[model samples]
Target: MLVLLAAVALTAGSVSAQTAPTQDRVLRQGQKGQGRMNMTPEQRADLQAQRLTKQLGLSADQATQVKSIALAEAQEMQSMRSNVMAGTDRRAAMQSMKATRDKYDTQLKAVLTPDQLTKYTQLREQQQERRQDGMENGKMKMKVKS
Candidate 1:
């Protein structure tokens, strides 16, 4: 029974991890820029709690539960990302990310209603597109400067 619960938590945790982005270090052109690594876990947790509470209009209990879920997910995702980054298997790393994402979506459906879930999906997609566009713009600027 304990093992079953652990397995369920692990599965849920992995899914949460995909939605939560733990800030990581990015190195480009031999210059390393640390992004979002200065904050400790507690700090990240607090901020995330605040954000989710505001965004989702979560009750106190819901906020606490979601924060706990997000933290576990973030830790697992961070570990997986680190492992993939340290090795040469980029394809495997991508597969891991996809699996994690799928798990996250599944868990979300269980937690949120169809309406809330739809809003959540839209928000996630917008965030992703914004991040991608920002990165692309940065690269373009770099090329122009060079």
Candidate 2:
């Protein structure tokens, strides 16, 4: 009887040990330079122009010109990135991006009329401010969690 009881107790103990609750920890990390293809430059420019038109009350002609400039910039940037991005090289990628942006800005300035350019510049500044605000908010959320 004693041996039988010992065997049952040992079996139960082993079963419980095997089935004990374990916490699952999942660590999510952001992917570098992912999903750029999903967002086409035409779509980006259209969205930007739409926002600006609604917010700044731009004329139809100005909006159309801006969209064209944006599309051209997007195509040029794509070409630049294709030529430059190789291996795991990040600095080269950044330099190419900067060059493309500078050229795009020059093209945009040339394409837009003076009044339109003024509004466009203001819109660009607002976009930058919005992006900065979003980053700050994200950081605050992370800090709150930690």
Candidate 3:
């Protein structure tokens, strides 16, 4: 169970990491030095919580709690990004980010039904695999490994 949670957390990271290159590309093309969408971390978290709610079919209370969890995670991730840029111990910061993501995964699991959790894990793994393949092949072709 612990191993599964770790994998889920790592897969979640990979899913988010997949978007980084696209965002970087946007910045490169934009005339502004820092081309970022005007989104507060809270707003971003709300969007994530909404996505999770749709995917997991969460109840109202669960959605609220998950949004709170997502908001905290977003704040922490921002801090981790700053620390990485500030020449803090990169590896340690990454580990801490992983741990923080794991904590969010654990909380989300508690709020999800057994079936929902199973589906969520599978979805994240599929996304991670898609991302890995896209990186290597220059196109996404979904295939589940045995």
Candidate 4:
């Protein structure tokens, strides 16, 4: 009887351990979103400036200016994100966000050279395509061939 009880307890313990992660997953799934968007403006600016430096081979002066631009945009975006999370209309909020993004793109264009602008445009298109391809849970939508 002692051996049988020990085996049963071990089995139950292992089963609970395996299921703990699944329970956490279910809890997250119940939330309305994927995760928090709480990056600080300085952090966001640094990351964006680094990406621009790598992609466009920007000068130090240009990277500094770009970081300033990114910081401003990040501050605005953080506000927008908070409002959206607070139950602002998602579609309207998105439109406002896009308008803000376009304004930032214009600011970036002013800082970039012509060649850099072309490369930036291409990069943005590629990013948009990638984003569209992977929206909602990493499931890629397939087009059916007629």
lDDT of 1 by residue, 92-129 (tens): 87888788767755764566656766777787899889
TM-score of each: 0.58, 0.52, 0.66, 0.67
Off by over 4 Å in 3: 1-38, 138-146
How far residue 130's Cα lies from its native spot in candidate 3, in Å, is 1.4
> Clashing residue pairs in candidate 4, if any?
none
**Candidate 2 worst ten-residue window by lDDT:** 24-33
Cα lDDT tens digits, model 2, 59-138, are 79868877887788777777766766545466877787888788868876775667767887887798789778978888
Error of 2 at 144 (Å): 18
**Angstrom error at residue 98, model 4:** 0.6
Model 3 vs. true fold: TM? 0.66
As for lDDT, the candidate ahead, 2 or 4, is 4
lDDT of 3 by residue, 50-74 (tens): 7788878988998998999888888
Clash count, candidate 1: 1
Q: How many backbone clashes does candidate 2 have?
A: 0
Which runs in model 4 stand beyond 4 Å of their true positions?
1-36, 136-146
Task: Put down candidate 4 lDDT per residue, 85-143, tens digits, no spaces.
Answer: 99999999999999999999899899999999999999989987877877754665566
- Tell me the whole-model lDDT of each prediction, alpha carbons only: 0.65, 0.68, 0.79, 0.84
